[model samples]
Target: MHQADMKLCLVLLILLFVTLPAQADNAWQAWREGKALLLMRHTLAPGSGDPAGFVLEDCSTQRNLNNEGQQQAKRWGKLLRQQHNGEITVYSSQWCRCLDTARLMDLTTPTPLPVLNSFFAGRGDGDKQTQALMQQFAIAQTAQPTVLVTHQVNFTALTGIFPRSGEAAILALPLTQPATVLARINTP
Candidate 1:
């Protein structure tokens, strides 16, 4: 091969080896540092919040997280424990899926916050509740890392972005303002 071609190939190979591991290490370090607040979409639910005839007050009528989703939630908790010593404050929507996901984590009993539920259910009261929730997160004083298990709509409303099922959007919460998205984790 030409000297120039050999040099270019070496550089490309170096970049491939160096950059990929660096990115992965960064992601791992981000988790270890607990600098990111995880906003997770409830695990493998087949449908959205509920059926048309679903009732907000009753989980039996809603489309909840299934057995596989429950197992996935537990797996996520195990991963967090292994990676970060399992220290996190978990918050969840009152909905069945979100609540179930939070509970399945087996980390802590999550605080049930109605504000984290999706506004897409035509729930008019969610706007005010969402504002209040945002304000609370904005002014939180705790140093422990936080996690929120919620629906896609609520996540989008807060972060202005949509996330898929079982996906986590990491946010950095500063002292006085709303949080900012740091990165996203889509765990298989």
Candidate 2:
């Protein structure tokens, strides 16, 4: 084989290795059946931590979803609409990125939850925020599935599963001290 062809094949292999499909250990089915919670990390916001002078109420002050992220969130909406026809309850962090992602999902109007906000970079107390989130979920249980759109830090604190941009983890109900992660799905 030619050197260029071999290089092309190597690149393809790397891409394949990195983009893993969500491992559904009944989690997908559970989510579709409205038995699990859907916790999502905000989609492809281009930058890292919030920029300086970050303000919770100000979109320009925070790191936010890019056009690609908007499109990705819409895809998630389409996927969710196809998967389950039952009612859904959506919650999102006050962050622009998270709120935008949840809104784009089109599942429902996302109610902002401060407990779901990112505690990364000393922005909030991770332990306290995580605990509050657990408590909130415990009290907010419903017959329909609940989706929480948040940041990587908040979700990781809850499930110990660091998420990719636009990733969703299927977590078992009654969110406990040690959350039961049923499955994970990256946006289609």
Candidate 3:
């Protein structure tokens, strides 16, 4: 290879190694700080929420996390296990996708909170409940880090940001400060 081409290849290799590890370190640091609140937007499920004829009680009537989503959730759980040594509380929306994803984590049996449900439905009560949940979370005194698994709309409503699937947003609560986009984990 030409000297210039070799130099370019070296630069590319250096960037690939340096940049990727830096991102991973940042993510791990965020997890360590406990100032980070990992808010996930469920896993891969092409559509958002359920269709017009959806039924809340029956998951079959809803647009749930598919096989890929399940795997992604499991992968996320593994990552958390490897990264965080501290105790982490896991919460999820009542929806099937959130519930399934939370379960797949296998880290903790998630507590189902209605407040974590989607705000996309534009339900006034849901919004009120969500706000209440946030307030509670903000005030609670827990030593362990907490993770909330909900929909993009709900995550956005809480932190004023939309999180992609399998992506986690870290929020500093109590003051309700701006949240940081941690990492987007692809389980596939």
Best-performing candidate as measured by lDDT: 2
Of models 2 and 3, which has the larger lDDT? 2
Cα shift from native, residue 140, model 2 (Å)? 10
Candidate 1 TM-score, true structure as reference: 0.78
| lDDT of each residue in 43-81, candidate 1, tens digit only | 878875578777778988888877888888988888667
In terms of TM-score, how similar is model 2 to the real structure?
0.83
Give the per-residue lDDT of model 2 (tens digit) for 1-188: 99999999999998766654434646766766666799999999998889999999899999888889999999999988877777788999999999999999898999999998888899999899888888876742456777899998888888888889999988887787668887778777
Clashing pairs in 3: none
State model 3's lDDT. Answer: 0.74
Give candidate 3's total backbone clashes: 0
> Against the hidden reference, what TM-scores do the models get?
0.78, 0.83, 0.75
lDDT of 3 by residue, 1-188 (tens): 99999999999999999997787677656556665566788888778667887767899888888788888999988888887866778989888888999999988889998888776766436557656766776742346677888887776666676667877765554415344455544442
- Which residue pairs in candidate 1 collide? none
- Model 2 segments beyond 4 Å from truth? 1-25, 139-141
